[model samples]
Target: MTESRPHALFCFGTLLDPRVQTALFGRTVPTEAATLAGHATRPLAVAGDSVTAAGGRDVRPTLARKLGATVEGGVLRLSDRELAAADDHEIDDHVRRRVTLASGETAWAHLDARPLRAAARIVIVGDSIAYGRCDPEGGWAGQFATAHIAADEHAHRVFNLAVPGSTLADVGEQTPALLPPRHPDTIVVAAGINDSAVPLAASDTGIDGLRDITGPLDALLATARRHHARLVVLGPLWLDESCTGDFEGLRFTAARALELRAALRTWCAEHHVDHLDLWEPLRDRPELFVDGLHPGTEGHKELYRYLSAHHC
Candidate 1:
């Protein structure tokens, strides 16, 4: 597993209050005084303060992005769970972003989240399956993005953020930066194949990075979860053993696929995340696959049909 990334939070409002901190975090939070650039303090337009301020006063302060403006704040030292708790306390309406403090510490700052309530925004993060590489229609998520927008505009705004040849760890490391300032309503994760890949030169029934699988999946969805996106997970595809050798410098087998798929399925059930299993239905359909790894055009259509019908 990759070394855990240090997460620092910049607080400019009630989050700085010790009472509020304790209420949300269950203890006093240690912090470093800092300043943020391109933002300034402002009166909140919210209906009421989410948390009451010190001394039972109803006073509240908020921050807005402003040019040439700076907000004095402190960076809070927090565990990953603590940071997520802070996000939950903030109502999940703020888009927490990676920022550089004036003192040069990389931290997370809550910024304006222009919530799009009218249109649905979907973000797909995964490897080649999510990328829709072999499909002419650009894959299932691609079909969602372009199906109705060719002439008539569709209310659905789909962001296909999948990268070719990415493992969940690789994608998790990069996904947060790829998120737009505006929060997406839904984030779909289509990963797990590459993690189970074994070299074509050899064969192994064992999956090497089992720890990496679930850990990386959590990391992959962390940002979206903080942003309050509904999640849909597509499990690892079932491999075709008859054509499983010597593709993409990896030897993939039905056994490896089943093993990897089980890992993902169990993790999903444990986490209470919505998981769609493609293993059983597609296990017998080898004709749709160009390689044991990727689906052909018709296969892409099938993938789209299933994902669209089941995505909630």
Candidate 2:
């Protein structure tokens, strides 16, 4: 319905967890313990911790398709907003379907769906570009998460592991450590700017020059492929005025950014990972960048728009 209204929802998974219910629906509603017919339940491999049911057993439950079977759950009357929120909480792995309960009541139940589009662990690693330098809240990662939730209606976590002024080597070293606890299904790498900007002496393998991050880039991609099933690598963004004019010996320029972008595009191709070239789409949009280097709020929005059109 267009207007906010109350709707009945059947939860079979971790939605049975009141902590999860409160996180997704804002507040827990009065739920009636109920049962759905002709379905079984199993464990799902998403990021959420195993839920402890009322009987003191930990489980990660997913609805299994079966004939003449029954599954126990609770039904909650949620508002239109909360219903939408519940849908978003389910993410890509689960789809909402109308089903008849054991009590002969037709209610909406979330069922497991496809793999990638279902509930997943998405991680973003990079430098200031991914970090949302100037406008903290408007970072592309945040925008993607919001849009992803709105579109998927399932809870997928986007962990932003980007650091300002971080080189590809830094990301490589951090990736193995970062992936524990919650391994990523899709990992996006947005780096190369810091590698191109910093001085030669500051880098470990910049023996070739400031932008010579081949060693680190290789290390990072290797780590990504090792820990994740799907990978998306992103290139550096465009800068306004050449940082060379601002800082001596620093060769941060549009040309350099383009060069780095091309190199990254080639690398992603070689690795057979999804690649997004951030330079071309954003190069001409001077207003999107705050200072010549980092993106402003609108810049982040533009980045998100470009990502939505190309990758998301």
Candidate 3:
């Protein structure tokens, strides 16, 4: 067994809330009232009275680095497990940094440093998998972005443009308009499963076979190439055994998935694009998928791990 290390972290945001602390660590650790210099707390809400605040307005507080400013917060000492849990709870918008507290002690703190986007712009376009169905947070997009930030000193923002139940036509229609004016560093296309499997009456009259979708897939790739973006194509994943029986009234068979997968691999090879076979890696892990179709939070974490290792 490995030794557990004692860790210290300064909190000024949601982690400062005792309720959040209890949820993350199971129990609140003893905290010391602390102050951080060279930082200031800013109210995130717009100028509105408490009673007159508009709906959908942000009312949370945020900490910012400012010269000669001081922010009052708490310093928490945590075990290794608690530290890991806290790291997992923080979203991609934050990073841990060393800071000096009012007591003249150094501790780590999560800071909102994602606004400093000094890295590449990554865009993901696809169906439910890219859309992160079932997971509360943004799913694989969030995982990938967060992993990038945590792993590298410099990282990029991941733009998820996937819409659940969308088809090739939907992607063709939305992607051109959704992309930024500037060329992105990387563009991942993970569609085609919906286009090939969805029933004709439900949303789209999906293609009968792989040949039918080649034209559209090529067109999307060609457009991405035109914009000078590095392209990555992800094939569809296998559904759970529970969904072996007719899925979505279209009987989403494994044969159909395999066919689409083959076509995708061929197209990617010809186009000189990176292709990830979602089926191969996830076929054994049925528990990661929820409802025998969509990836759950654990599944999204698995995807993040694979993409981080192979693609990112």
lDDT of each: 0.68, 0.67, 0.67
- The best candidate in terms of TM-score: 1
- Per-residue lDDT for 1-312 in model 3, tens only? 876777889886667678778988898777788988756666544343332243345454556544456888888888888988887766544456455666767677765433222125667788887888889877877777676556553434567778887776667667877775634645678763675564636554654545566676777766665543445677688766556566666656667777788878887667545667778667877788777777899888887777666544
The TM-score measured for candidate 3 stands at 0.56
lDDT of 3 at 100: 60
Ranking by lDDT: 1, 2, 3
Pairs of residues clashing in candidate 3: none
Candidate number of the best lDDT: 1
Model 1 spans with C-alpha error above 4 angstroms: 1-119, 147-155, 200-207
> Clash number for every model?
0, 11, 0
Please report, as a residue range, the 10-residue window in candidate 2 with the lowest summed lDDT.
48-57
In angstroms, the error of model 1 at 284 is 0.9
**Candidate 2 lDDT over residue span 164-254, tens digit each:** 7677777877877888666565667887476666443465335433345667767765665454234567767778764335444454666
Candidate 2: stretches off by over 4 Å: 1-119, 151-154, 198-212, 242-244, 247-249
**Residue range 107-187, candidate 1, lDDT tens digits:** 777653432211256677888888888887787667767752443354356788888888778877887887766456556
Error of 1 at 167 (Å): 0.7
Model 3 scores a C-alpha lDDT of 0.67
